[model samples]
Target: MLKNVAVALVDGVTPFEFGIFCEVFGIDRGDQGLPVYDFAVCAAEEGPLTMADVGFTITPPFGLERLEEADLICLPADRRAPVRDDYPEPFLDVLRRAVDRGARVLSVCSGAFVLGAAGLLDGRRCTTHWLHAPALIRRYPAALVDPDVLYVDEGPVITAAGTASGIDACLHVVRQAHGAEVANTIARRMVVPPHRDGGQAQYIQRPLPRTACDTVGEVIGWTARHLDEEITVEQLAERAHMSPRTFARRFLQETGTTPYQWVLRQRVLLAQELLESTDDTVDAIAGRSGFGNAAALRHHFLRTLGTTPNAFRRAFRGPRAVA
Candidate 1:
């Protein structure tokens, strides 16, 4: 259904963020049996657009009129997007009209600011890059901003966090349109993980202790390989040659989460993969993912993903797969 796509660019566009839109939607993947979108880059104004932080200019062949035909309109991050209070009214008006007519809109990083300028983010739950979250909130006070998650999807609008999370948001759109099999195939071609768990909290940098310790890292690798087996803080401590309390303390410092929390997240991730890729029953998947039973798995899955395992499978299972 998402056959037509357009990327609307203003001046000072970040090359990487702009390229993210191009990579996901603009590529010709028809040889691989993937959907090839009718994609175009539309300049928001007349004259060549300048690249941010780099001294170069690009002249897009398409103008704002091209956006009128797009099913999905993407806004990539630009340095001026968040800081500038005044945006081109004509550009903003086009975006407003596009959304009013049932077209979906997505923003990457600070690009959410453009949506904010268009009044599209008002009363919507959205997010921007973690570094820019406070600024986005200050500018658009009515927008509910969640800075920790990789992205926020609120029906017609999708906003992604800094940089690479754009890939996740774009892949999510593909998944919704086609199914997990198509999304996974594209992810495989891109050489990035099809799914990522937890939040940007794990990626936040923290100062490490002066003393070097590979014990926690080694235990984590072991636990991943042995996820089907029961693991506990005490057992992990024994393996690391440390007391349970000491192990827990170090784990929180190093991994930004407790041992149990990390293992549980990993199990849920495994279960999601199985649900998408295989025809395994809930009971079998639960056992393989270390939940031991379907009920426990269901509880965790719902708490983490806001959906049941069966419902998730029903939504994501490939069309060609047996029912």
Candidate 2:
């Protein structure tokens, strides 16, 4: 029975996040046997609202008062959202009131910050884009912020991390309210996955932040240059002109990771490059990236990236690319 969807817009709103809600709820897809909600875009502040990083202004058809009647209020990511602490009180109040009245409030990316300001996320499990998760956590300590998730559905409050995951979250709402068949049909029309679990880890790739190493500098550079070779701490220590124990300690101090872990992490980055740019077979890429074989490559890749090599390729290079 979920209907009357309204997207609440604020200053510096991101068009992509706003568009996700529109694509999911604003459009009239009833002709295809889909449930079309009563949707409207509302402005939180008066006058034209500027888009984030874009040189255009959009005038919403409705105002903050319109949110009071909504079955679902969608809050999209905004550029000023994370730093700009002073949100319109009227805007935040309506959101709180809506949730109190049993209306669901869904936020995408940094839009969760608005909910946090409204005190809606207090003591509730929520998530935001991984890049912004730390900021969210620091700002809203009362909110249980999980950075490693695609989305979190805390009953009436749903928070989605990043862009595609926002789409996944919306489809999740559709799946819950209507049925799996409806959600699947909508996913087919949008050409996206029908169901990506809320618990799926965000594919976060944190590369080595340093090319300029200290003490163990030469060894670090040498390791990067020779990723395809089976490297050991003893070999690295000898190359660094130190004992194995001393080298290991210095390696941890200088690079913040053990020799073995650094090698494995770098090899995965190399494997990612091979998968994306080159038409290399998984087995071939595995050996070339020093994984010995595809099985080892798959194991390390999944462990670090939370996704399989083939799946990563499909997502990065598109479904047409042969894995």
Candidate 3:
């Protein structure tokens, strides 16, 4: 199992992203019967490393050599990461050696850029924060970049989407290394979910309606509340007092996705929440989440999340429903 954990810090590391790994791996919960990893925070540079947009500097207790002993090495978000190409050669070398030696590496948000610079992400599926997705693609043409998901676990290399998604990715590591019960316990202590729904896609910003019209916003709220019912763009357009084509155009402009995609994502999110929080069977969740039947729910769940509903529930709900 994963026991030794180390964080490799470069200059301008964002505090929250760095904190995620520390919270997940560095804490000693031996009294609670949880495994305690040998954790260290190591610096890549010589002097006090500067934090981004902050007034203070940090001097890590360990050096880059500590990473050579780690079972898992974490890279947190650095403010200059998108344009940073000056990572120390020794720092990059240790990363490559870690992978070649069967150790795992995880990058949170813009930290993926550091992995990209080290050529760790070449030909592997990875992700960064959605805003940096385009720049990541431009910088590393060989990487398979998926911008919508919360995280990707490509065997030895794992990448998370943004600040809070770092929490998800770290818990995922814990879940895989330890088990669901241990990960869920850690999540409860941190006041976070062991698993989360949807993706960074929900948080992406879009241009508002040019005419300052809030009709689309109202329709979105209405659709969210009535997700169990059959919803069509025609019905939504009539409610917005606009033609179907006009409504579709305005919806895309205001929401960055089509009406159909928006509803499908919402329904999937609802199914995920119900599966996590309720004792409902798959068929019940399907009816409540607007999937109509278990087969439909399973199909969409796989297409959207790459996992079946029963497996997702088993991950989060302790295998209560066997489908």
Candidate 4:
């Protein structure tokens, strides 16, 4: 149903954020049996649009009029749009009209500010880059902002957190519009993960210890390659040449999560990959992903992703999987 797509660009547009939309929606991937969107980049007024910090400008062939017919409108991060009170009114008006007509809107990072300006984020659960989440909430107090997660989907409006999370949000849209197969295909071609767990918390950098030891880091690599085995803190401690308490402490300090939690998350990620890529039975996937059985896998899946495996498969597989 999402056949037509448009990226609404303004002055000071961040190239990476804008490129995210173009890579996801603008490319012609028909040869891969994927949906080819009628994509366009539209400028608010006309003429050359300036890029942020890149010392360059681009001429968008389409204007605001093109947005009226788009099934989806993407607003990429623009540094000025979020902070400036005088962002173009015509652009905001068109955004409101497009959503009023039942077209979905997606915002990557600070672009949520554009939706906030249009009053589209009011009464909707949304998010932006964690650094800007407080400002977004302060400006639009009516908006429910969750700063921890990578993205939030509030029906008509989808908002993604900083930077790379835009890929997850765009792939989610593709998965919803087409199927997991198409989304997975696109992800494979792009050489990125089809799904990512956890939140921007993991992305926040912390100063590393000045010491020359990275025992926990090596253990983490080993754990990833051996997810299917029953891994205990004692076993990992022995591997890391530390006591159980020390290993647990080091793991948390380095990974921001306990060893058990890290392993469980990895298991869930493996299960998700298997579910999306293979026709293996639930029990088989559970065994392979270290859940041991279908019931355990179901419990973890429900707790982590808030959906049953069968329902997730149905949503992604669409009509291709036999009931």
List, in order, the clash count of every candidate structure.
Answer: 0, 0, 0, 0
Best by lDDT: 3
Query: lDDT tens digits, residues 125-186, model 3?
Result: 99999999989999999999999899999999999999999999999999999999999999
Better of 2 and 4 by lDDT: 2
Residue 194 lDDT in model 1? 79
Best by TM-score: 2
User: Could you report the Cα RMSD, in angstroms, for every candidate shown?
Assistant: 10.1, 3.8, 7.4, 10.0
Candidate that beats the other on TM-score, 1 or 3, i.e. the better one: 3
| Predictions in order: lDDT | 0.87, 0.88, 0.90, 0.86
Clashing pairs in 3: none
**Candidate 2: stretches off by over 4 Å:** 122-125, 141-148, 196-205, 210-226, 229-264
- Residue runs of model 1 more than 4 Å from their true location after superposition: 205-323
Ranking by lDDT: 3, 2, 1, 4
lDDT of 1 by residue, 1-323 (tens): 99999999888889998998898899999998999999999998775999899999889899999999889999999898767877789999989999999999999999999999999999999988888987999999999998878889998889999989899999999999999999999999889877876554333332322324698888888888899998989999999999999999998898868889889988888888888888888999999999999999999987876667886777567463333
Candidates 3 and 4 compared: the better one by lDDT is 3
Worst 10 residues of 4 by lDDT: 203-212
The residue ranges of model 4 lying beyond 4 angstroms of the native Cα positions read: 205-323
Worst 10 residues of 3 by lDDT: 202-211
Mind giving the per-residue lDDT tens digits that candidate 2 earns over 1-323? 89899999998999999999999998899999899899999998886999988899999989988999999999999887778899989998999899889999999999999999999999999999888887999999999998878889998899999877889999999999999999999999899889752233426666555634454887888888899998999999999889999999988887778889888888988898889888888999999999999999999888877788888788778866677
